[model samples]
Target chain A: MNTSSNDKQITDDLMPQKFSKSGMIWVGILSTICVIGAYAYYRQLRYGLGVTSMRDYVSWGIYISNFVFFVAISLVGSLITAIFRLANVAWSTPLTRIAEIIAVSAITFASLIIIVDMGRPERLYNLFAHGRLQSPIAWDVIVITTYLFISLFLLYVPLLPDLKIMNQQKNKNSAWQNKIYIFLGSFWKGNSEQVKISDKIINILCIMIIPVAFCIHTVTSWLFATTYRPGWDSTNFGAYFISGAFLVGAGGVIVAMYVFRKHYHLEKYITELHFEKMGRIAVMLSLIYLYFNINEYLVPAFKMKKSEAAHLAELFTGEFSIMFWFAIMVGMIIPIFIMLFKKGRKPLPMFITGIMIVVGAWFKRYLIVTPTLLHPFLPMQNVPDNYKHYFPSWEEWAITMGSLAGALLIVTFFVRIFPIIPIHETITEQNEKDHSK
Target chain B: MKKIIQNRYLLLFFVFSSMLFANRSFAQEDAGQEIVKLHYYNSNNSIQYLILESTLKKNKVFTPQKDKTYQIYLDSAGTNLIAKVKTDAAGKGKAFLPPTLKKIWDASPQHTFIVKAGDEEIISDFIITKAKITIDTLNLDGIKSIVATVFKFENNTWTPAKDVEMKVGIQRHGGVLSAGDEETYTTDSTGSVTAEFKKLNLPGNQKGDITLVAKVEENEFFGNLAAQKSVKWGVPTKVDTHFFEQRTLWTTRFKTPYWLLFMAYSIIIGVWGTLIYLVRQVIKIKKLGS
Candidate 1:
């Protein structure tokens, strides 16, 4: 296994391989979760939204928060792949496909989870039919649809040349791989003119995706901000959401980097340098996000308008205090501290920190949506006592976890088919490095 | 020659002017009780009448109701015709339409019959008293301000209408006002004008009575012109009071509810989402430059 293997041999080795024994078990577990989630969704549909622990008082719960988390994580596609390419940062070439696939899968479920949150998903056509221009839900529908198409295109256009490579060099791919490659990119000739057109199109789409990426999360923030509830009624919501989204997205990419590197034996490609750089970026994002959190929570707590005081106190020390403090410490503060050390920026520590940030961010979103609803300006009264408390029903948990597993399964299958690293981009960067030497 | 022409024109104008003045005087003299003035008085003393003109017919009975007790006979049917009246108390059961000696036949030539007290034979012939009762316009003007007047005919005398009932009222048809003899006005001539009118108080559906009457000399004939005059009166009917009461009821029927605020909030959320979507699309397209 010479590290400086010839280009043909390298391409052959790097092409996607079949699942190993653990890979099969992992797929089985994800598939099982997805099936259970689908069954839970069937029960939810049969029993109405009432099947979840949501009610009139806590009208929105884990489903909406999960949707926000998925959308936030999906932003990594733009950051790791598009932003790095536009800046001509060459080291990220190996991780670009992993980020894009993660983005595509997460956003697809982000859209699905939102539909799951809907009371009448059967009338999803109402989004187009009676869709009012003035409504924020309609806006989310329009932008989410646009973002999905753009993300799919972004992932597809770059993979065309690779697909052609796998198709022409059939010795490396199985019968199924050869079929997928031919079905996807048989028309790609890899001529200079086609290459030039593809490059120009990819560049245009990458630049276009940035603002859409920003807008998807910003509008998602406005869903809470526009409400009259004390905790959600903040002008700081949009920027706060955007900053948190970037932090979580960077964390997701780090997690993917470690897992893909260890499992696929791509340690040579995804090296310590990639981890250290991403670790530093993640730490900086966590700090920036911490700044936004302070602005979002502290400034309001200082004023403590009579309407807001009770809600603020509840998060600080009341029933919700545990979750509130937990999300802040784990999601922002701990990650910042962990990644601050030089040794902590290594692959294993960074992976652990990434997992902490991701989990903390999920609960943070839940705290954002659920607590505000519970603390509406009018006191909660006369409703069933159960309405005052929120704990996701098993059905809700199943559906939410299934969506999460579904997103991972898509990433899993994507890696199975396409080379998780962009072979052409990495070879080009490698050639440039050799020439420079 | 011009002065002579002017003098001839002036002479012709003087002749025409003198004839017009003579005609106007003649018209006023002919206009008698046919153009008598009417005023609503609070008491019988206030109802002083200067005799306009009078005409009385012989053996005529002016029975306002099915029961009557007086009768009269006229000597002639023109101005200055004299008439004599008798009462059932005096064993005479007829009355005259106009019972004055100064005028007789010049009054309308219609005869009214007084039925006897024991006249159990119900008369089939009904006389034309009023026709085509049409409500031109029922105005609620002066509804709050109107001092409702009711009247009753007394022994050989008539009292003018007076306010007796104070309660809810409509201006025209019928309403409740003050009721009792104490609320009535007394004339300086020692005439007691006791009136009773129904007082309407609430908003809708009035069911009460207000009867108005002009008192005639009770079964007695009087030659004095002042004694012959009847006091005029008006009272609130049940129908008029109902109209204004119904108006107040509708004013209280229009008040709004609490769920509308939440619906408005949802509409605002829909609008906010739309704007964010549009702004993002515009920015994306600009970045694409396509």
Candidate 2:
């Protein structure tokens, strides 16, 4: 095909399409869940956090676990978009938008879930009005806000060229869709200067986002680590959290990549090669996370200090033993074993592995937050028997699931509104490959 | 049909009679198990009163019999009624000896008190004796001692009440701390017990003043008597009222540590400065396109 025809075909293939019947059903289901979650939040606001099962001892329940999960999953944007771009990995070009949207949506809900966790959501102003600098909570607020903005810019800057392309395809979009394209990208003339400036700023953001992403999760880890609690007082917590975050974030991206590739029939662009590479990365991340898990748990188990003994025992052989082992074996070990083999790196197997990792990682966060809270340094005294254990009430579960559904809805709408794969970059890369050949 | 109706009526009558019989038996047993206690208290100002408590035992539980009335008399023959006491919700009642009993009270050193409830009477008699306690402080060459003496008025003379047991201690809000290792001290033949002060560096008021207390509690003859003496035997404590004003991690938001504030603000400004620049650059991109 001639250059002009080839470019036109790429744009035609990559432009946003209307949702199919299944897609509409998916959206409807997600909207229902979101509505349910909204009602749960309303109940939480109307009554109090008493609606949740959290009490004095197990104050940090699954809501906090969900928050950590969202924060952990958000790190994939940095991994795929910034780290891969800076490393000049050519194959990751098609997956950048998927990772970036996941990061954006997850972080958005991370902030929302925190507000839902608050008993007095109206008192949120206290965080800024009287926030103490010495508090790790204050540090987390600062870093998360900074990371969200940087991730947004990273997502937006790369889309300018694609937005301009979508705007030119006037007959393909509705009137409102065309207006949205204009409002977002009418200023993008795509001249050499604009492209140059966009490239420079994207590079700046790529570097700036790496540390901010690390700080976001590390400071979140500090929120627990700075406490004197048994399961949380390790110096290894920050690196441990960061490694686990990368694993889960990569799992999220891999899952997204597979879903988009199959649903959109972009097998030619996404390719088996992409899955193989991501599988390899997931394996490496899982192994590194496994190493850190050993460092976090094994050393403490060896000494078994009186304070840490009960917490470690609960995780290793006590009430949480089943979940603890599931998170380790399924989240890290089994995925590592699966992806290490060449046959297991296929798209379907990789997808299953990704699901395993994500589910296991969620339970891992729950185990991390709850077991330690149950085994506090002080002896459990005079509290209700229910206070000594934690299980998310229906409201907590609905709200958490709703937040998850809400995040998925955002990504789903984003996919319907914009090309899941970057049209301009894919074309440019294709052109470069053809010229080289 | 008439015989059946008569049999039915007879069965109903028997059931009601049995229920009434059982209820009356239970009431009698409860009344038989009722308990009463009387106590006398003579205050430091020489005013005296008596307290009465009534309770009933049922099913291994003691329940207060509230709103019950008891009559107090100066004799066993139900004559010379001194006062009528009524119980409150706690099953306790209080009454003072009436002015009419003054002559009877002063007529002898021994007196009898009688209390009467419905179908029950209790009598208690005791010898009334007046006693006084005197506490003295001695700091001879820094060997501080608390000496307490007990004297009883007998035969119109004050005589030493030897072998009397009393508690000598430094006074505290909750209770008294023993001046030494022993909890209580016994008086010698001279009616005095000396307790060596052994608490070291005890904190006291700004002037190093500590109140030493000597108490003869619930004595059979003396009722209860106590004396106190002030001594200078503590390390004076001066509180620092300005502690909260200092900048520290535990302080209020306005008093956050300077070093922390500086570090946090520096990091915030540096990071946000870059973000502001990036925002300005994006606006510039929009302008450039325009």
Candidate 3:
């Protein structure tokens, strides 16, 4: 009777809970923002990209930058769930599910924002119907789709046992919850043979995902590096992008772990040790990204080629300087300084640094995309004066914010139905410890 | 419901009343006032000036309600201070333009100047022409540099062209009809200009032949003129002799190695094949309990 009660208590604590009033209000606000964004996008679709401030010179703007940011942050799922698992690291198990969810949501929106960036999004299907395999865009579409499915599988495979557990507590959960669990994972029996097969499948997926993840981000960096633009034309872009991506992704995971821990009151499961480990990881990644940043800028500045000089000047001391400095300090440097200290690795301070890294990384993407485009080799001439400079219009701001809110809403709904922290995995770990003792 | 209907009726009454009063004020502000507007008048014969004569469009348009002071000025690069003229109530004004202004103009001898009155401005143009241009290719021996002698009809006869710039180009013989970049060269005191070109500057026929051309395009002052001569350049035009061997990242042509294509296909097949298999395995698990 005592063992059964303890199991029931564990089940209740790990099960997906109903949304509190605050959660409902948060969802409502996000939905409203999404609706507004949808309306703004509809206007853009009707009127064409002309409604946005993007013109001939600054053809690629916030949309491309946002897409890059999404792709960058999406890399964390592979870093945490796949790489860690393949490395046989045990500490990352509790955080795996959060990382995977972020990857799925971010990549989904990464694909969406790309469609939004296109002038004729209706013709997006044409990429498949009469596509040229030679195009870089075709390559991106292929890899992102592959990465998305792999991410989804990585997310879903782990949730099966949890889904099965949810299906068991017949009376405790609502009818909708029971139906979802059944539809998703009624096949999960938790038998030794089944567990053996599941473990083998997960191990294979974890191994398979590492290269696919690298390919997705490497191809994304090639989209810019292949261009003739001075800032984008560099051998360092792929490694630079990958490193920066890992840093921001780790930052994102830290941010999410803190939120899920505090809000869901899963402090017992997501302990301070996870924060310390993640904080150390974040610092290391920030340092790697910082090195790449130096290589990306320093080598170019040394040459000061006539074409590259203008672009470097713009980033160094001209109009984009403020954003450049902000991104460097808040995104990489400050977080590095803070996370280096033991005291700074505490959850609250790490959360603050995580948010800073994320926000700074977004502007860093902006700095990467827009400033380079503004300094094309040919001088800007014979265009409208407004085309001389770029600032995101109200419609752009609304759509960008809306896309962000939409991603959050996805994570929100995901947590509402599925466990943010993996219940079955936690239980398995607890069982293993007891047996070992 | 009854009170709401009463309030709606009251709102409609005020709305209708306000519109009526608004229309009355709009009509009062209009006041049947007519102002004389300005227009441009073209002059066929003029030597030293561009004329601007304002004409009224409507029958009662030119009220001449007061002095209604008008100003006549040439709009040179928008400086708006070239020259002005006075008109005595006849609404007539003339703007004098410089003959050798050298302001960059379109490919037209006629240039437009403007006249501004109280609220209206009129544009009028006059003809400004340059001396006749004549070009001739000089150096027939050397293919490295082209020397073309140009002369202008000034002071009644042919003279060495001074301060006249012309473009030198080569019409390519290979492939479709196209020309190389036209290098601009200004005539020296001797009216002879030389264009320096690298060896094989323009593509030629199988016999290494190409045509050199010297041209002066129609500018604000000079009408267009061109002269051409044949020259045998260096090597034969490059063909697709080694296209297959030359591999570059930019080209999408299939490589003999077939490695990239094979690798891409393998990754696609392997990843998606494994994915489909995993999904099927998940489905097969449902049969386990049954």
Candidate 4:
């Protein structure tokens, strides 16, 4: 296509598309899940965390696992936007907005789900009112909050130019769209100085976000690592968490990239090459995660340190053995095996690998949290017999699924306003390529 | 003014205070046997001994039990019989600290020592505590000189206890100092006296956290007093491994360490600093258009 025709095609294809029937149906289903989750949460609030099967021994059930999964998936925003940008990787540019929205949405739910875990949600203000400097819980509150805002800023700054682009396209949108654009991006002139400053700020954020991102997850790992529990006490937790987080995040992006490409029909922009690169990246991260997994289990298994023996046995051959192996196989092993092949890196196959990774990762977090709690150093006694073994009550499942649905809802709504692909960046890149030709 | 006041401890007999408690209900009354007056004795915490004094009340007047044998049960739960002794002509019988005392101590902080002869019985209620030595607060210095005190309660007022042999030592990481520094020395007539621990061992914390414990071993009066005070002495010599000094990393206590404070503030400053600047940049963008 010629230059102006190409511009027209790109704008039409890449601008925020309307929700199709399936999209509305997807929205409806997600909303229904969220409403059910909200009701479950209301019941939890009325009855307390007792509505969930979590007890004194296995106190942190699925809610913590879900929170961790959200935090883990949120790392992708940093991987794609910050790490890739700093590395000067060009191919990921079109996918930045999608990745960041996922980060922001996942983090929002990560924050919310943790509160849902708190028996007294009203006590959250106590974190600020009597916030201690030494507690890992306090460290988490600080870093996660910092990560959220930085992630928001990172999401917002790049979208200014695109927001301005949508603003000028009077024929394409409604008055509501115009109002949102004016409220968020009316100041954007696309002037050289403004772009210059925006780019500088982006560079600063990309650099600054890297450590904060590492800290948020590493400190989260410390929440478990710092404890004396059999499975959680490890020097290897930080790297282990970060690596798994990257794999899950990469998997999430591949899934999003596929959906956006197929649904919006933007094959030319989000191409086969992107999926292939992401697959390779996912495999690399999974390998790194696999190494940590071996270290996390093997050395401890080698010692059988009396404390860790039961926990390791449960993971190896007991009740959790099945889920444990499944998480390892599907989350890490199977994804690694699949993505190793050229065929597997194809969009359709890659999408399946992404699903496997994301699902497996969620179970992996559940294993990380719940199993160790069941195997405390002391005998699990005095608590009700049910406390000895944790099975998530229906309310827990609903609320966990709801928090997930809520995160997806945020991503869904973000796409409705902001372009899933960056319009201004895409056009500029295309213009640059055309000029060079 | 609470002056030096005849050393640290003043023993006072508070019959008036005991009289103030009127119309109290007790479980059972002695059938002619006066309640056992239990006195725990120790000199420099060397030997722990319990002295039991029982007087025969004949026609509601105090009289010596002469040579009657009374069995003293240790725990209030009545599970263990600690000692059997014959009362002296002066109305006193005695027993040493038994190994079972620790087991009974674990269950209840307050111990009920029961003395019985035939149908007549007398019970004494007492609390066991670590004997602690206190020094006026002073800065850490080598060759530290200090004094500690013990008091007895009798005659309605706390008076300086006499003949209290307080074992003075520091609590080590492990191993009890039951002997060696076990020599018995009586507290002065004023109930307040000083013991100089020459060649004192310093617990390596440059800012000392070592507690000097003064244990008044088995005494005829006071059961046991384990008083301890945190002292900074001898330029603390132990190296602390914790990066944050607020509380050791292993502790369950919630304390904000200087390192964490620095970390939280540093990130907050870096992040919020950049964000405020970015917000200003956004504001500048609006002004550029207007």
Candidate 5:
């Protein structure tokens, strides 16, 4: 195709489209789940955290697990958008917006889920009012907030040119939609100077986000590792958490890629090659994560140090054995096994493997948080029987499911309003390729 | 059909009335089972007090009955009213024996204390007696001992009160520490009980002075009597009161370590400064577009 025709085709293919019947039904289901979650949160507020099964022993329950999961998944934005951009990987251009939206939505809920876990949300001010500089919690607060703002700017800066395109295509959008586009991006005149400055700022943000992303997850890991608990007291926790975070984030992007590609009929854009490449990245990340998992468990298990013994036993053979083995086998081992082959790297198998990794990573976070809490250094004395075990109540499950649905809803709404694929960048890249030809 | 409906209505009325009466009767039974305890206390032969406690049993647990009123009388007949007290949240009511009853108390060798809560009453009688305790310290060959003697006024003469049980210890802030292993001691025929000081290297004030205390507590005849003596028998140590002023991790936000403050502020300033510069650059882009 000629450069002009290619640009036209790219723009036509990439413009945001109306939802289909299934899309409408999907949105309706997500909305219904969100409403139920909102009601559960309302009940939690009206009553207290007692509405959940979290007690003194299992104090950090699935809500914390959900928070960690969100934080973990959000690292994909940094991986796909920032790291790939800085490394000069041109293939990641199409997936940048997808990764950025996932990061934005996941980090947003990470913050909100923390508030839900705080039984008295009003006392949230105490975190700022009486914040101690030495507390790891304080460090987490600082880094997570900084990461959110940086991620927003990173997502927004790249979209300026696309917003200009959407603004120009007035027939494709309603009057109100055009108004929003103009309000957000009318300043983008697409002059050479403006493009130069935008590129410079985007590069600066890309560099800045890498360390902040690492800090956000590392600080989250420190929230556990800083404690003297048997399972969490590890020197390798930061690396362990970061590796797992990258794996889950990459899996999340793969899942989103397959769904958006099939739904938007973007087989021409998100091709089999992207899935194959991502499959390789997933295998490498899974192996690194597996190494960390072994380091996290094997060394301690070998020692059978009286302090870590109970915690390890609970995870390996005791109450949490089923979940532990499931997380390891499905989250890491099976995905590694499946994605190793050439056929498994195809879209359908990769999608299934992605789902497995994401689900397993969630349970891994739960096991990381809860079993250690159950096996405190101090024996479980004088506590009620229910305190010794943890199972999420209906409210916790509702709220957790609601958070997941809410994240999907955000991605869904984002796709409906703006092109999920960056139109301007895609056109620019396509023109460059055509010119080279 | 009308006759059957009338009979059913009559039966329902009987069942409902019986349930209501059953609930009322259970409540009345619970009310009748309120427990009242009366205690008399005379401290230092100067202050006399009457303490009354009220409680109710519910679900096999004794729960305090707050805001319950109780009347104290000085006689079994309940004629001489001394004080009226109300229970606090802990179900205890306390009142000092009023000066108005001093004449009646002085005229009698024995007195009856009565506390009445509604229809329930508790009576306790005590013999009026005067006693005094004197604490003495002895040092023999590097061994220190605390000796206490109790005497009671009988037949218009001061005589040693024998076989009176008392406690001899070194006085601490909240309670007394046993000078030796035994917690309590009974007086011999000479009305004296001795306890050897066994605590070694116990820290004390800068001057190394510790107060030795001896007391006869709640005796049937003596009420409560106590005596104390100060001795230089403890190891003196200086305390630093300005520890919190030091810069430490556990200190308040204001007292954060200088190094930590420097590092944290540096990161904050570095990151936020970059963010601010980026924001300004975006604004410049907007300006260029305009």
Candidate 6:
């Protein structure tokens, strides 16, 4: 296994490194975005929902869709870490921390963005007080909270050993970084007892997280499906949502892998093989999602009932037509086509494809919520003229962008603090690879 | 001497004949007695009239009572007047009597009556029978026209009237068409009164009861619409009977079983809980297998 030289390299290469010029620029950009988002949220609170173009008709706009998007992207963590680990897929070991960080950050913002979608944010307590157990929103609260805790636990358990390692290795970075490491991980004595227990607990939590992840996304889809809306009234909604979630989550991993590999020079850890494998998973999920799309659209199209006709027509040929088809082609079909090829599954091509899928899926969530609401049972009538249309205001855009940036910042900070690749798992895998050779 | 003799003889003869005739007439009349010419009229409509006669005397005191208050029973049912009355100053006064219950043997049945000083209270051991007034025809130009076959108990059958004669008074069609409109136009036997509109511009739906009312010679006719003892021809127009029926039905339906709501909630929650559990179990096994 070339233990001596490999150990030297691992110790040197895997240590928490300083942010370079580009890394600083990226952090600054993300921080600026988060700040803008905070200010925008303040404006929204003051002016009421009136600050947003969303009226009573389109009660949920971009923030809710983006929230769903973030949650969807977050599931990649469980898919890569727990699902692959249980499946004995050794290639995904190095990518586990990377995926888990993304999941944690994305789920965190998903929760936040949901609060932003609320009209009576102050009366958020009513959710607990007056919560009708039958309401999908109540179910969402229950399951999402469960998912968040499990995901957080999953992220934290794996980071304990890494935290101890960081604390032991002295660095030139400021005292604050050292303090953060001490505060977060000082309790870890690195005893075999702690390590064994931590590993067992992490395994249990990772296994628990798979179903919880499925529930969070599935229930989120139910939030739309439980409604009488034409577009959302499908039994295939849970599968549809889960498949699309895996696609976006995988796309997120691809993009994150590319970014971290380039910025950190961790090509040895996050290799082309990871990108290729992730790209294949992304493509497979995209196709599965596209198949559900056919079921979601085609069966309804066959009959085109009185209520569904207008909604379907709007997606097919009306104002939403462009966005609808664009999301399908760019998000699912194009990414599927790109990932089908070996060269396209390379890091650079996969990153571009991942970006397309993420962007497309965002629009797709928007498509899921808006078009159905616009075409209600009764014609949109007796409302203000502007109520007929829904274009998110600047505040909505800012909060949405901020939430995205916040998720990124979560991943970025997580990577900054601990090894983005699992240092222990990667070294172990590298030893195995060397032994196999 | 001759004049005194004539006066004594005539006085003796008059006293003897009056004594003998009184007993014979009283015995004969008592054998088959019936209340004849029993009819009612309300000159000033403040008082309502209910009639039941006793064959015991020419004048019977009557007491009136309401059959029911507004609740408990459906129609003024089970209510009765316990008081009695005699005839009035002109041998007639009003009594607000409870409606008759014809089911009982009428040997000494209680009937409400009222009277003034000269009126006598009478009770008879004879059966009281229902009586009705009948009219042959009704016609009101441009509004209503009917050959009204009214029934009366005469010759032991409820025979329709062969002939009818009366004057009907029509009120002026006020701008708002209703019984509230006030004026008078009389119609004699030639053309009897039905509900007919004088002006076509009047609201077609405007209606009121056409009461066959008689005038009392001595009493003043006050403008009390309720005072008229109306022999209602068809039906009263002022009352919305159906509206009250609908209101009653609505109130009764709203008292539905409360348990239905709880059952619905329980079913919904139970189904959702089961679905969550099933999905959770499936995902758990799938994760373990993976």
Q: Specify the highest-DockQ model's number.
A: 5
Candidate 3 residue-wise lDDT at B223: 41
**Angstrom error at residue A373, model 5:** 0.8
lDDT of 5 by residue, A93-194 (tens): 889999999999999999999999998899989999999998889998999999999999999999999999898899979888899899989999999999
Can you tell me which runs of candidate 6 are displaced by over 4 Å? Answer: A433-437, B1-290
Per-residue CA lDDT of candidate 3, range A1-437, in tens?
Answer: 34457666667776777888988999999999999989999999999999999999899899999999999999999999999999888989889999999999999999999999996998899888865555677789999999999899889888988888888886888898888888888888887767776777788789888888888888889989989898999998889999999999999999999988888888888899999999999999999999999999999999999999999999999999999999999999999999999999999999999999999999999999999989999999888898989999878888998999999999999998998888777776777776787
lDDT of 5 by residue, B128-186 (tens): 46567778988899998998888876665667889999989988998989999999999
lDDT of 4 by residue, A1-437 (tens): 88888877788888887899999999999999999999999999999988999888888899999989999999999999999999989899988988999999999999999999997899999888876666789889988998998899999999988888898896789888889998988888989888888888899889988998999999999999998889998899999999999989998998999988898888999999999999899999999999999999999999999989999999999999999999999999988899999999999999999999999999999999999998988886666789798899999999999999989999898888888888888888899999999
Residue B260 of model 3 has an lDDT of 59
- Residue ranges of candidate 3 with Cα displaced over 4 Å: A1-3, B1-257
lDDT of 1 by residue, A1-437 (tens): 33357566657657888999999999999999999999999998888888999988888899999999998998888898789999988788887888889889989999999889896797898778766544567667767876787788788888877877788788867888788787777767777666766777678778778877888888898888887888888898889898898899989989999998999888888999999999999988999999998988899899999878888888999988999999999999998999999999999999999999999999999889888888878888888899998999999999999999999999999989889988776766676777787
> All models, DockQ values?
0.01, 0.54, 0.19, 0.27, 0.60, 0.01
Q: Report the CAPRI category for model 4.
A: acceptable
TM-score-superior candidate, 4 or 5? 5
State interface RMSD in Å for all models.
Answer: 13.1, 1.1, 3.1, 2.8, 0.9, 13.2
TM-score of predicted chain A against the true chain A, for each candidate: 0.97, 0.99, 0.98, 0.99, 0.99, 0.96
Consecutive 10-residue window with the lowest summed lDDT within model 3 chain A: A1-10
Candidate 2 lDDT over residue span A200-319, tens digit each = 899999998998999999999999999999989999999999999999999998898899888988898888999999999999999999999999999999999999999999999999
Instruction: Give the top-scoring candidate (TM-score).
Output: 5
Instruction: Name the regions of candidate 5 deviating beyond 4 angstroms.
Output: B1-39, B42-111, B115-169, B178-202, B205-214, B222-237, B241-246
For candidate 4, state the interface root-mean-square deviation in angstroms to 1 decimal: 2.8
Error of 5 at B264 (Å): 2.0
Rank order by TM-score, top first?
A: 5, 2, 3, 4, 1, 6
In TM-score terms, candidate 3 sits at 0.68
TM-score on alpha carbons, each prediction: 0.62, 0.75, 0.68, 0.68, 0.82, 0.62
Which CAPRI level is candidate 5? medium
